[model samples]
Target: MATYEEVKDIPNHPEKYLVDVRNASELKETGVLPSSINIPLPDLERALNMPDDLFTKAYGRDKPAIDAVLIFSCKAGGRAARAANLASTLGFVNAKAYKGSWTEWEEKQSQNI
Candidate 1:
């Protein structure tokens, strides 16, 4: 899995995908990445099983392509790692977890809020 710092250096590419696995409340408590797919982990199962048309309806038609780099993040590393593993098993080629997550992000930035 790539560290947030490492990914930060990657040039902005529309092909890269950032998936935030945090729930709505957690996202509210800790801000999300500027451009990220906000798909809570608990809802992963249904989304995975969604029919092609339904998938577009639920996850949006712009859901990142499977070939794109899938970076998953949560409050801590635990959930993000699990989500990454699941994505890998499901055929996401470049699935990765942001091990530091939001806690580390806030700490590294020294953001009080």
Candidate 2:
């Protein structure tokens, strides 16, 4: 799993995949990381298998390479961890959860301001 400090650098690294596994309503209420992809936890597996063109059209980003550095985040950490586990089990070699997830992200952002 990634620490808060590590996750903070993800937005600047376009080559990495940052997935927000939170639902639509949570995303609407809390916003999201600037370059993160929003794939609800329930849809993650299907989305990952989508054709490149279809995935890009739906998510506004290309599907990540199997070996890509994939970081998953949610409101807390449970869901993100689960999603990361699922991705790993499905053969994504570098999938991991953001240990602090959204709660830590929000806290850090507030501190920054």
Candidate 3:
């Protein structure tokens, strides 16, 4: 798993896949990471397996490879960790949770601003 500080560098790397596991309502209330995609936890697996063209059409990005460095985040760490575990079980080799998740991200962003 990665810490919030570690995740801060992810946006600079185009090959990484950062995913937000929060519900749409939560995302609507709180902004998301600039490079992250929203694939609510419930739809994660299906979204990951979508055809390349379909996935791109839906998410505006190509689907991540099974061995891609995938980082999952949520409001806190719970759901993110769960999503990471699920991704691993589904054969995603490098899925990891953002240890401090969205809460930490928000805190850090506020500090920067």
Say which prediction, candidate 1 or candidate 3, comes out ahead on lDDT: 3
| lDDT score of residue 18 within candidate 1 | 71
What's the distance in Å from true for residue 73, model 2?
Answer: 0.2
Question: Candidate 1 regions off by >4 Å?
Answer: 7-11, 49-53, 111-113
Better of 1 and 2 by TM-score: 2
lDDT tens readout by residue for model 1, 18-39: 7788899988887877567778
lDDT of 2 by residue, 17-102 (tens): 88999999999999897678899999999998899999999999888889999999999999999999999988999999997888
Candidate 1 vs. true structure, TM-score? 0.80
TM-score ranking of the models: 2, 3, 1
Candidate of highest TM-score: 2
Query: Which segments of candidate 2 are over 4 A away from where they belong?
Result: none
The local distance difference test score of model 1 is: 0.76
- Screening candidate 2 with a backbone cut-off below 3 angstroms (N, C-alpha, C), the clashing residue pairs are none
Pick out the ten consecutive residues of candidate 2 with the lowest summed lDDT: 3-12
Find the 10 residues in a row with the least total lDDT in model 3.
Answer: 2-11
Instruction: Give the root-mean-square deviation of each candidate in angstroms.
Output: 2.8, 1.0, 1.1
TM-score of predicted structure 3: 0.94
